[model samples]
Target: MTFDPVMPGIVLAVAAATLLALRAVALLPAARAGRTSVARWAVTTVALLLLVLAAARPVTGSAAGERNAQRPQEGANIYFLVDRSSDSAIPDFGDAPRITAMRSDIEEVIRAHPDARFAIIGFAARPSIDWPLSADAWSLQPAVDALTPYPGIDSTEVNAAAAANILRYQLISAGQQFPQAENLVYYLGSGAGESTVPQGVFDTPRIDDGAVLGYGTGPGEARLREIAGQLGLPYVPRRDGAELPSDRAPESGTATATDPATAPQPTELYWVLTMLATALLLVEIYLTTRDLRRTRAVRRQAPS
Candidate 1:
């Protein structure tokens, strides 16, 4: 048996001992018989021990189960192509910064597709993977939260074709890594905003699934819609109550997606321990009250 004590074992031991000692001292001048006093002391000690056990939080499982907790499975791979251009920092989205809106949208998509693994590509002058593909959604939070628009790069001069090429490369790389998973790309930006694309070089890459999600309060939405049309992907414009279209990714049904047959299961035993401790406390209370009543009855029977 192993113990994962909430507090240090020595600290709990000292607390239990100190409490019992204080109780023993309080009960010394009582009119109860020696055996009754000892019985009360034992009950108190048992109650204390039960409480400590509950706090310790014991668990029993094989070593193999823990090691396989994060088993990979077949699901969609979501790639977030986020634009961190200087234009994205404009504070017009819901009267807040556009970057704020982008973060919210990315998180919303993550929650929507619980089964899918995710990667993040932050694009300004050029696109690069801020976060690699992983099933752990929380791993991408810090990078997104700390996202700031790159300085000294004019959004007007960004090359859309070059940025798209980087995205294509990352998507192909992720596809190679997880061949079984479907690729879904979510573009969170006002696409190609004032970014020049040389004539005959505006070729849009083929995306298997997902849409171009536009975020702005200006003419960028029109440009984004054009980009989406060219890429043959659906366009979702930012609005007060806009929703991502249904064709993006497959939804997780009633069953939890993470817990596939191959994944290990984690079982918690804290609730059982807590219940046991509560039962012990009730028993201790009953015994103490009964002993007090018996002592009072004996005193009443004695001559005064």
Candidate 2:
């Protein structure tokens, strides 16, 4: 069980206490005048408490269930190795720059795997991790959107394999940390540069699934296919109006929809609390109305 309060704990506690105190004070006169009974006051108090508990938003789940709910399907980690080389600036993918297509595809990938953790690495003059691995998928949008072409003056040549070593290191570390998890690598680049590093740098067994998304129809397209082949991943060319291939399905081993452990756990008990509070409030209202009517009838029969 856990609580995701609608407000700060201190604030909610103080507000609830203050509300109960005020309600007691307001109804004291009615209780003393015989218009509201002790039972009525007690019901109202319980109702208010129930409302406060509802606002606290208690969640109930077993330890294993909670762990499973937090883990992505098959505990997949998606890595995006983007090319920021000067060739990426080439406006060859249907007049738009390669970065534009890369951004669109990255966004689509993120949307495709809402539960997967994501990391972004951009390579240009050298390799840099633009975004670390995070479960908050949407948070990578700013980093992806900010990617630009590497300055042509910074380096004479663009090496697509510049980030291969770093990527390999990261993959090895990820495997160590999560031996059961799958690593999906998506390399988005124009692949215009020569392979300065040795081949098979990205052929590690850690990469379980992914594709090399080539953005332009330029001469570098062939080189991009080579990079894909080296990584043992499929190469998919992105054109202006063509739809992306659906080969990158979200399903993984032991994480299928039929698996009870992978199913979404119920994490909210607020609605049940709210309904109980409402029922108590209705009971309080009925009792109060009945008391008031009886008191008025007795006064009418005895005095006027």
Query: Which residue pairs in candidate 2 have backbone atoms (N, alpha carbon, C) closer than 3 angstroms, thus clashing?
Result: none
Please write out the lDDT profile of model 2 over residues 1-304, one tens digit for every residue: 7775655699889989898888878677757867446667777888889889887767676643564444443456888999898767878777888888888888887877655668899987578988877654544788888998867524346667667888888888778655666788899987755434432345555578889998766566887888888888899988887776744554465345324455454456877898999998998778779879999999989955
Q: In TM-score terms, which candidate is top?
A: 2
lDDT tens digits by residue: candidate 1, 1-304:
3444555689878877887787767676542658766666666666666676666645456633452333233457788878788877778766777778888888887887665678887877677778767655554678778777767878776544345766667667766655655677777776556766441122434467878888764666776777677666788887655665666333556343343453443344655767776776788789879979999999999998
Estimated TM-score for each candidate: 0.56, 0.59
Distance from true position, residue 10, model 1, in Å? 46
CA lDDT of every candidate: 0.67, 0.74
Q: Pick the candidate with the highest lDDT.
A: 2
Task: After the best TM-score superposition of candidate 2, give how far the Cα of residue 204 lies from its true spot, in angstroms.
Answer: 2.8
Root-mean-square deviation per candidate: 15.1, 13.9
